[model samples]
Target: MADHHHLHRSTKNRNGFYVKMKFFRTKNGKPEKPFFVKHFKWILWFSLSFYFFAKFLNNHESSTNNNSLKTSIINHSHRALSESILQKPKTSHGLLNDLKVYIYELPSKYNTDWLSNDRCRNHLFASEVAIHRALTKSDFRTFDPMEADFFFVPVYVSCNFSTVNGFPAIGHARALLSSAVELISSELPFWKRSNGSDHVFVASHDYGACFHAMEDRAIADGIPEFMKNSIILQTFGVKYNHPCQNVEHIVIPPYISPEKVQSTLLKSPIDGQRDIFVFFRGKMEVHPKNVSGRFYSKRVRTEILRKYGNDRRFYLKRHRFAGYQSEIVRSVFCLCPLGWAPWSPRLVESVALGCVPVIIADGIRLPFESAVPWSEISLTVREADVAKLGGVLDYVAATNLSAIQRNLWDRKLRQSLLFHDDVESGDATWQVLVALSRKLGRSHRRLRVSSE
Candidate 1:
């Protein structure tokens, strides 16, 4: 009876209230429990309760500390750390769900035959060729269309280069692609089986499936009716209400010759001293024309030339340079102003060579934003803010330039922006697979099993 008497505990809980409890006898009492059996349930209950309470408090405190640490990193002065909020990949999330892709073996006329033009597989717009080449040899590819999660349509539309100008003449793109779709729809059961929703097409050109270089014409034409329901992997994207990108699509980076980027890296290491302050060597016409009621670069190029053309810190040129990739490696900031289209190859080239890209295109949606920290790695100057670019860039150089450079030079980040002949882990091709895996809800195979 004395051992079972209630007592007041001086120890307070988190609420600062003293706890009252009964004392247990260890020695003075008769062995009614045999010191164990009689009160075994209470002892076990108290022990478990204490353990659970301790674990709960520890978990709550640990979670709070972790969240505070993440907040501390984001609020740090190095602006690049602000990427902690963006959905950037902490890991590659490699080959999610064992995703499988099926490549439609259309006649050589639709794909491989175009490779006869050596430039077809190596040009700036050659992603249409590279992805297909890589997929045929990738683990994701399956010859059995029945087990495929998504069907890949390989059509080389950007290969018909004009002899006179050496630029891709894509006038026949719509008809050529239309023919391929017709062949697959009639003979193959896959396209019709899924209503083309599980099929994927690559439009590595100026305006995506609109298939025109001119934006006005591209928008007027719009994504083809046949391709509207299918998935399109394209380079053309804008964060606006544009008809050209109204269909299901993923923004992909334009093709940049990996060999050329590698060659430039060999000549000048990414960590090498950048001699040029600001570099641009593409077409910056002194007098741009309003072709089809659109001025070249929308006068953005001319504005850049007018404002910083003579400034020693800004190196602007109007002519073509073959060794431009080498120059990019030796530059601090590379100008990626809008050309005929909002997207440009310079975005990839500059990043690969460790040059900070000064993007002047407004509303441009970059590729693999989830994998590549675009906001942290590059500077985006709106088209309206072109005149003040000098001040803006100077401020960045003074404030967070090193942080941005550190993010840009990350080898895996840069590799995500270029397509290699083969799929390397975390490369652009692999990133595409990761993206497709997230869209597995669209897989007809999964739907069939669930419904059945």
Candidate 2:
């Protein structure tokens, strides 16, 4: 067969060139793993679908940029706490703008002899340790109305101390602390009165003695606009001479209490049994017919009880029972009559209970800065000299009451009737009540040019 048909056509052209070189070495030649594992499983499924579509578009742009930075910090903290509670600012110098009045806490409604059995029928007669030494440690029930700039508050409630009911009762005036619970709970939007400002009352002592007997019942019962029409009233101490403007003491806290001489109502003047203690009681009117200092204090207490009638240590008290500490430690002296005149509280509780006060009264001013060393203590007298009170009780029976001269006469009677020793009239009445509360927080055309 012509060489067997050329060796069978050269073994069928070398077996069809080895099946086309194994299909071009598995489609192109080198990368061959079982046909290059079927084209490497379509290039690993298009590279895992483009790496999960770029990780789902970068996690949806990182959750929309973390919810736009938490809604821009909650709308800038709700527009800064709502413009700090709507522009808060009522007086105290539009809310403390450099105000400096320095500590004061008054809280009145007096009466506290376990709620009264008639202890000095209160009129704001102090004693909570003289209102904690006049708020020096700052507690006035609990002060801090934003570190006060003005706070006198005593429109008049009167304290007769009673609870099983009988005379002008109601009490409690709070504020022990915690910033007075944001000042009496209004949450201090600068004590709003439309941020205009006004607050201060302080008039008592019979409405600063006749503000026309309570100014037409405080302007037809509302007490002349209670507060905030840019408030301003200001009548405190020296008053009652009536007939127009001058009143202004207001620096309170000396209603007697140097720990009322360690009170427990101080009884032992020899365990009392009336060794003569008499601070008046009930229906008192020693003789008030037309009160010309009433029949000379019962004709000078009946000539000192007819010159000490059988000397049971003679006595005569009243001013509602001389605010007791055992009637001023079984008093050796203290008559202080005036039956209510230019001054009272018997010239400050018989010179803060070391006793020896006599006074009598006629135009008595005697608070201090002048004739006070009364030969060491006190004994005024004159109301047309009640027949020279038996020669001033024979010169107080020839003087002899010493306990180291009654502790140097109770330290010169607490430096002349303690007004906390005139700290410059309590810093000029707290700078005239904080300049009339910044002149009623101006701007009604500056309060009509400050009330003209």
Candidate 3:
């Protein structure tokens, strides 16, 4: 009975060991897989998927935060600009002090009839109107010439010349301009005091300061001699060009009609929605008798047309001013090539409509170059590379393009380009006044030091 019990106990022990070994070991002595190891592939897949999903969520949140921040900043900046515009301009310091200007009330021949005529040459007449409006509304104007920082001679030279049909008629306009200057010089003691250096005039025409006739040189009291020391404002200002070539001179923007300005201001489209890469609508073929030799003579526009005439990316049309506003609103960039002169009204129009301008004019002096950061706002292309305009535009990064668009959309920049009827401190007229004030102040300081 004792032997039988011992054998039974030994059998039980051996059976227990066999069962344990079966679960813990394989036949070749390899360890059996754990619960996790049994579904290793599924577990690994789940872990990887979870990691990726968490990463995606994190990135999404970060992007949302960034977008929100950008929106907040833009809103804040816009609000600040609005508040600043409503406030009166402080003339406590800098160049915009208690500035005084004296405007000459010239005879009807010099001013009234020229302005009354409907056929004004270019909208250069608008400069005269804008300045007059600004003077009337602002505290800058003075009745006494003795207390003035600058004297304004509001002679509508451009308007007078606009009525002339031929080159022979230019002599009559020249005589009128010369007589006006002579009258101002003889009547006012101010012109004699500074040799017209302190006098300001608007000659913002394609022809620099309106001395177009060869006969102007022969006349003793011509526009050229009178404007030698004056602070002349012109449109087509190159460094080497006459009248505008002087250091005291300023390049003013061409006028956009009230209708055009209002339409563009109201109907400006979003930059991202602008489907057309580049849009240009103007005269493609220059007349053989075109005196300026700026249009087809250089072959810039013709070359661009030859290369990109059929390109869907580029929209080049001829004499299509009726749909100009619509086209500019839908275009990402506006091509502003030199027309009769280096400067064109299209440049200012492009900025007003929030279209980044691609300037094709070489040696062109832009308006308010000192105050406006044009290089940051516009793109310059060489005439030789007109054919490669597509590639040049394509190579510009999306980020840079967006930045330029934002600059174009800036309210202050747009306001500065506009001609407001009232004396707004940041409008085109106000900016011109401010520029003149600064220049005059510097000249005064230099004179005082020289005398000392």
Candidate 4:
């Protein structure tokens, strides 16, 4: 029986070498050092590592009905993930190509001084502030101007709110921007070196670098000569040729706080218990006045008000509501009609808060098309078809609304639209860097390589 088969002792080694069980008693059955004492350092290392790894995965892995708890976990995860990418070995996606942006430190009047008014950072036009703040703290920010691929000129021109109408008075935009250019040009050689070709500026207002809300006036004003060669990151864009978008530009999403989105998400359900059918809260004029023959919102909003003002299906409100975001989270379809500009903040808020956006802007160019699947996630209704918005939404609700919402809820898409305090991987600022990385041929560093 022994010759046929037998189980060996636990100490048996097939390689004819001693494999010590350090935890076990040694030769004379006398205990060596205690296992816990010997392996304490290794245990501590693993414990600490597992702690961080588990924290990073907590929100993605665990499912719970407590949305507030889920939100808390996710906020923690976002912070941890943001910090990890800066210190850890770099990965491929998000902040791709290790893109570097050198933020120009102008006088306080150009940037921080405007932040004395809290609205400057959170308003619809606050991307001018958000991107600047994100870049200043990011690892991609190079301290040496010589090493920078692109220079960021931070000029906050939207914070000067009109005391009368509460709208930003951008009358000072051009002068301030030109002054910033002049200061940077005289102080640094980078501006003249590339003729501002490698420089980046934010024109997060209605008509981009033209710095006007009125399209006709904006066209007449045109992009400033000093900024004509620079790369503009602006909320304004269009499909057709327009004077405002004449320069090299990248379309950017209007600023909406990520914290605001998260707070709303905490109180909201997973799939969102959307009760309101069609949601619109902003101005829907009953009688749109024509200014220079261009009616308000091209009279599209006026048409909506005339048709659906009393329609119970469409939850329309004309007055201001600070908690409009809460209403957005509970709605099925959010109306993102045009205002002075084709693009609106609701487009980002609706997508971020889980409402299916029904885009009513014509000839509008959306931001981050490379990262965001706009056509798939959002439904576009022509400006002429404002009268049929109800039936069109009804058809979608009956047929493929679920599919659209699923696409809209993709975290990557949402991430690519909002700027956090620090640049998070796959967030809005990161997408900007990704877009800039593709334009490296315009950079001075790359030009030096070509000449060499």
- How much lDDT does candidate 4 score? 0.85
What are the C-alpha RMSDs, in order, of all predicted structures? 17.4, 28.4, 25.9, 11.9
- TM-scores for all candidates: the values are 0.79, 0.25, 0.70, 0.79
lDDT of 1: 0.83
TM-score rank order: 4, 1, 3, 2
- Give each model's clash number: 0, 10, 0, 0
User: Which runs of model 3 end up more than 4 angstroms from their true locations?
Assistant: 1-95, 118-125, 160-172, 213-223, 240-244, 270-272, 286-297, 397-399, 441-452
Which residue pairs overlap in candidate 2's backbone? 33-36, 141-175, 141-176, 142-175, 142-176, 278-317, 279-317, 279-318, 280-317, 280-318
Which numbered prediction scores highest in lDDT against the true structure?
4
Q: State how far residue 417 of model 1 sits from its true place (Å).
A: 0.8
Among these predictions, the greatest TM-score belongs to: 4
Candidate 2 segments exceeding 4 Å error: 1-133, 139-247, 251-255, 258-260, 264-272, 277-327, 331-333, 337-359, 363-382, 388-452
Question: Which residue pairs show collisions in model 1?
Answer: none
In the range 310-422, model 1's lDDT, one tens digit per residue, is: 89998888788787787889899999999988999999999999999999999999999899999998999989999999999889989999999998999998789889988
> Per-residue alpha-carbon lDDT of model 3 for 1-452, expressed as tens digits?
87545644463587655655655557476657666778999999998998687667656655676433233334434533555678765444244766777677666667667656554532633676566656755657655555568878876655644334522133355567678778777755667778878888776555556544321232223346667788877665775644435536777888766456666556654453687889998777633224443234267777777778889988999774665777787888899987556678888888877789999988787888766789988999987778778988987645588788777777677677767777676778878887887776534434554689
lDDT of 4 by residue, 200-302 (tens): 9999999998998888989998999999999999999899999999999999999999998998899995386888999999887788967778777988888
Candidate 1 ranges with C-alpha deviation above 4 Å: 1-94
